[model samples]
Target: MITGDNQHAAMRVANHLGIAPELVFFKASPSDKKTVIQKFEQEGEKVMFVGDGVNDSPAMAQASIGVAINAATDITVQAAGIVLMSNDLNDVLKALAVSRRTLRQ
Candidate 1:
């Protein structure tokens, strides 16, 4: 997982998620997400982006799969292919776990 931040709160979120500071690319622009997505796409990786902010809309739309909370802004929800029913992070985690398990099967 990678993260970037223009604010301390953003950086703190990354840190809270246990993402290494080095792996977290902090920046003041949404272009950071675009750049990161481009790199992964260039590497032939299928990328999925999950976000609830307007700033994340562009990159999320660019990704192979975009997941957004139902409670997110209309722009974000519209850009995402998957609209999560729950606003809880734990619900997201559970969905991911289920997906992984199903894939393993």
Candidate 2:
């Protein structure tokens, strides 16, 4: 999880979500987020970026799968490959499950 939020707050959220501290990037700028996505892509990794603000647009566009929440900013929605109509973040899991099922078929 890469976030523009402060380190302490980002860490708290990462902990709650069971994300490892090494995987959490705090105080990240839009460019930083994009760079991270690019780096992962260079390493042959597929990145899925979930975001809801204009600041997230660039990174969203850079991701292999960009998911926008229903309440996300217009820019974020435009950049995302998938838009979740529901406000719940758990919808991301649902979308991934559906994608996996489709791929298996």
Off by over 4 Å in 1: 1-7
Model 1 residue 85 lDDT score? 86
Off by over 4 Å in 2: none
Would you list the C-alpha lDDT of every candidate in the order shown? 0.78, 0.95
Tens digits of per-residue lDDT for model 1, 35-82: 788788899998877788898888888888788986778999999987
Q: How do the residues 1-105 of candidate 2 rate in per-residue lDDT, one tens digit apiece?
A: 899999999999999999999999889999999999999999999999999999999999999999999989999999999999988989999999999999999
Kindly provide the TM-score of model 2 when superposed on the true structure, using C-alpha atoms.
0.94
